[model samples]
Target: MKQGTIHNKDRFLNKVADRLNRKRITEEVQLPTWSKQPQYEVFDGLSQDELLDQFVLQCDAIHTNVIVTEADKLNDDFDKVIQDMGGGSIVHWDDPRFESFGLDSALKKQQEQGTDVHCWNYQLGEANIKKAEQANIGITFSDMTLTESGTVVLFSDKGKGRSVSLLPQRYVAIIPKSTLVPRMTQAAEKIHEIAKEQGRMPSCINFISGPSNSADIELRLVVGVHGPVQATYIVVDDK
Candidate 1:
């Protein structure tokens, strides 16, 4: 990707500093310490198993199916999810973790059985969006999970199209145990660390909680109004 250039960045900052009756400060500012940190207190001492239980309960409230399985059995569980969703065309991200999590075999098997399987291809560009639109299901690995909200965080890139999750009729997120956190507070901190380490940020970061729903029509709740009608999370015990 081409790096963006800032026009007169120093001039802009200098003007702001001048208005504030101070010179431009080049030093890093220290973050203020808060007196009470209640955000960290929720699920602070919970074990991973406890967090998983909470996550499952939250998912149920949101109408999302949660499947807990071992990494070794991910292939079978994934296949079952596909079958349950009424297998047809499927699209997934171009992420190698699918193979690491034992899902590649399932995807390959589906293809061999004449099921349409499309992996997001950067080279194909807009064609990838078309495939996602035509797909019955779209799959992706969660970059970070918020157990409090039953949310799956996705960092979109060239190979990981946002359409893979939004355009499909159904969405599937593969969540590793280690990726689960107490809530968005922890997820935001991790994302800040990633941006600092990488010296750049992803084009898009999506925090999806359950299926697409809206209450716009006569104040009645409607599902799948703007995105996937059905969503599922397969949590792998890979920690």
Candidate 2:
């Protein structure tokens, strides 16, 4: 123990902490008042429909396409988003959404409706790797994360993999607003905690704050050198 340490400090400290943790403190701690918002604001207190509108406006500011709608509207929004992005036909798919959500019927219908949203569904063993590779635009929900800088961390288990965020020309992510926080660093710390508890490292830990970009060219900047040229984040209000 350190010089200032007490022998029974763990239990005592916990008891003190419990006493200090009142309902008001908990509520205020979760949703803090920002001193000010930047010209580009981080959203709060918006409904799902409102959030969708806000998300779309921000996307337009950066020339990124926005798509929203649960599995029910996936076919429409999914196809519309791709077409707006200037992509032709669904040349491929990553298939993560289908197995996790069984969105095959919806996805297949879009394919038939000239979405060109491809899905072989050949049952080529127990892997969905190839489907994601040829996809024009991959869609999935994020595991709840940052609001500032528009970052979303899609844990590989439930949502799309890190590759889907990178390999495609454009990427779209759906974030439930209830999970939003102020910035990127907070998301990192939370992921670290989840990582420690799991006793195994996540296969991929992407800290995406915006579109894929680089300025390492010949004295000029460029985007999507190694990944998507553009990125879009859709925040949905579940409350």
TM-score of each: 0.94, 0.57
Tens digit of per-residue lDDT, candidate 1, span 5-79: 999999999999999999899999999999999999989999999999999999998989999999888899999
Q: Model 2, residue 225: displacement in angstroms?
A: 1.8
Candidate 2 structure quality by residue, lDDT tens digits, 188-236: 7778888688765565667665576566767666767776677666554
Worst 10 residues of 2 by lDDT: 119-128
Q: Give residue 109's lDDT in candidate 1 (0 to 100).
A: 99
C-alpha positional error of residue 171 in candidate 1 after TM-score superposition, expressed in Å: 0.6
RMSD of each: 1.6, 10.4
Clashing pairs in 2: 90-116, 93-131, 93-132, 94-131, 94-132
In model 2, where do residues sit more than 4 Å from their true spots? 1-76, 87-105, 114-133
Per lDDT, the best of the predicted structures is 1
lDDT, residue 196, candidate 2: 82
The number of the candidate with the highest TM-score is: 1
